[model samples]
Target: MTLILAHRGYSAEYPENTMLAFREAAKAGADGLELDVQMTKDGELVVIHDEKVDRTTDGTGFVKDYQLKDLLKLDARFKFASLPNREPIPLLKEVLEWLAGTDLICNIELKNTLFMYEGMEEKVIEMVREFRLTDRIIISSFNHYSIVKSYMLAPEIEIAPLLSDGLYMPWIYAQSIRAKGFHPHWRAAQDEIVISSLDSGVEVRPYTVNKDNELERFFRVNCSAVITDDPVNARLIREKTKQA
Candidate 1:
């Protein structure tokens, strides 16, 4: 069966990357969670998508400029004004600690492609090791170099490259980087590509898959997983596909 991973933790209905979102995603029966991680000025790992806080939070500057304490002050609920309480940016440590108690898999996308957060991989790996959740964690990045560095630091944990555009024989490219999986944009995950890659032992899990037809397609095809903002809808579609 294809796994349903909540993209940014059931972000369709809740403020993304917030504890509320993750908890709700688990309650909705998602198999996993996909989230982004970036480093703060104080060298703390934070769970947010962008290099800057302008888009997601009430803050206006780069995430790298703020100390963890200062960063936590910005409400992550900027996009969802209807939400009542302030949603603070969560620390990687806090998320990992929470994840330790669950059976859900986590795909932690290192947000270092733009700013190159020095030592971010090491810090993330160390934290995962500390939490003893290495087996259930997957480190992914659009920066192939960052993915390679993470693989070197902890080969026991799975690592994958995030692709926005299609790559020729991505499984081969993944093998070159020693990546155990591939997370591609939905369009990049062609049927032949998915089948061939999985046959080659490279797991393929596409991102941001939300449409009912698309969700059912991935489920029927048996790709490793589908990362979507609406895991609840995705889970429902998966059941329908199974019944068919």
Candidate 2:
């Protein structure tokens, strides 16, 4: 059966990457959680999707500009005004502490593609190891070099490359980089790509798979997992496809 990973943690309903979102995703029965990680000005690993907080929070400017203390003051409940609580941007350590208590797998996307934060991989890997959650963590990045560096640092943990465009024979590319999995755009994860990759023991997990048809298709094909904003709906669809 295909696993359901909540993209940014049930983001379709809650603010993306918030603790509230992650908690809700767990309650919704997602098999895992997918989140983005970027370093702060003070060298703290914080979880947020964008380099800038303008889109996701009430703050302006880049995340790297703010120290973790200052960044926590901003409300992360962007566009969710009726949510009835101020959602502070969570520290990666805080999230990991929370995750250590749960059985859900975590796909931590290193948000270092745009700004190559020095020592970002080392910091993230060290934190994961500190929590003893290396086995349950999958470190991914759009920066393939960052992914390679992560793999070299901790080969025991699973590492996947995030691809926005179609990469021909992604499994082969992944092997070249020593990646154990592939996280591609849903469109890039074609039937042949998915099936062949899985057959060769490479995990194929597509991102932002929200539509019912797409959910059913990936589930039916038995891909490793689907990273989705609507994990609740995806879980239901997975059950339905399994029954069919």
Candidate 3:
């Protein structure tokens, strides 16, 4: 079956990258959940989508500048301009614990900037091992060192390289890092690129592909998965496509 990975846990319905959101996505029958992680000032792995907390939380500061205690104090709201009571930022451990027995797979995207977290890669892998979720998790990152170090730390865990702007020949980079998959932007999902990744035997799952035509193109080329904001609509599309 074509995999329907929920982007930030059905972000269209709830706050992105929250435990509540992930739980809802699993309940909605999403095959997988994609989440982003960044290290707090105290060197703890926290689930969040942005580099700064100002956009999603009531607090105003870079995540790396605040300790985990401070981050927990802030309200991780949805639609910051509208509903400020949605949810709070969830720790990566919280997610691993919640997904212990569930069938949902995880795609962990590490948000590493220049400031660098001390042993961040090892810390994430240790959590995955403690939870015995190495096989169920796929680590990804825009930072090559983070993902590459993850591979060095735990070679058994699957890794995907997220390609966004101006990344031509991503398959070569993926191969260099021994990545199992390639996650490119929706606009970068060309047939040739898809075919090339397939030829290289790497899974090519594009992000935030919500358009009908884009979804159709994904299915037409048999891409590995589609990370989308609308799990309900994607699930319906998957079901109808199967019936067809």
Candidate 4:
């Protein structure tokens, strides 16, 4: 089966990265959940997409400038703009605690590519150990070094490298870093790239591939997973394909 990992939780319906979003994704039957994490001024791991709180929240500053407590006060759902209720920025610990009771896998993308968060690897690994969810978590990042450091910190945990463009013979470099999988953008789902990566024993899961045609292409090529905002639709497509 091509795993359906909800991108930013069921973001098409809920405020991205909120508890409500994650719960909705699980309810929609996503195999796993994918979310972004950045460190706050107080060194707290916050589950928001942007380096700055300006896009997703009502706040007007960099995430690194505010503590988690202050970030909590900001309206994270404001960008959704029409919702009457607001969700606060959640901590990584809170999310990990939530995952401990469920069978869902977590693809935690470290949002430190632009603004490096020192000690992020240790903090995340510590949380996974605390929850005993080392097996269920997949640490992913665009920052190759962070993923490498995460692999070094916990060789037991699976690491997936996130890339925007398709790498030429990606498995070579992926193997060099001991990455267990590749989390490339939807554009990287070219047949040759997908086949070569799989042939190298690396699982490929492309991001934001919500459309039916693209979903079909990935499934046809036997990619391991598709990270999407519309898990409901993706699941339906997977089922429909099975019957066809």
Pick by lDDT: which candidate is best?
2
What is the model-wide C-alpha lDDT for candidate 4?
0.90
What C-alpha lDDT do the candidate models reach, one value each?
0.93, 0.94, 0.86, 0.90
Question: 10-79 in candidate 4: lDDT tens per residue?
Answer: 9999999998899999999999999999999999998999888888888898999997789899988855
Better model by TM-score: candidate 2 vs candidate 4: 2
Error of 2 at 204 (Å): 0.3
Clashes of 1: 0
**lDDT, residue 46, candidate 4:** 87
CA lDDT, candidate 3, residue 148: 85
Model 2 residue 163 CA deviation in Å: 1.0
Q: Comparing candidate 2 with candidate 4, which one achieves the higher lDDT? A: 2
Query: Against the hidden reference, what TM-scores do the models get?
Result: 0.98, 0.99, 0.93, 0.97
Model 2 stretches with alpha carbons more than 4 Å out:
none
* Candidate 2 lDDT by residue in tens digits, 160-203: 99999998899999999999898999999999999999998899
Worst 10 residues of 2 by lDDT: 37-46
Residues forming the 10-long window of minimal summed lDDT in candidate 4:
77-86
What tens-digit string does per-residue lDDT give for candidate 3 at 1-244? 5698999998888888888789889989899999999889888899998888888778898899888887898787647446545577999999999898798899999887655777888999999999999999999887877788889889999998888864677788788889988899989879888888889888898998998778877777778899999888888877766666
Of candidates 4 and 1, the better by TM-score: 1
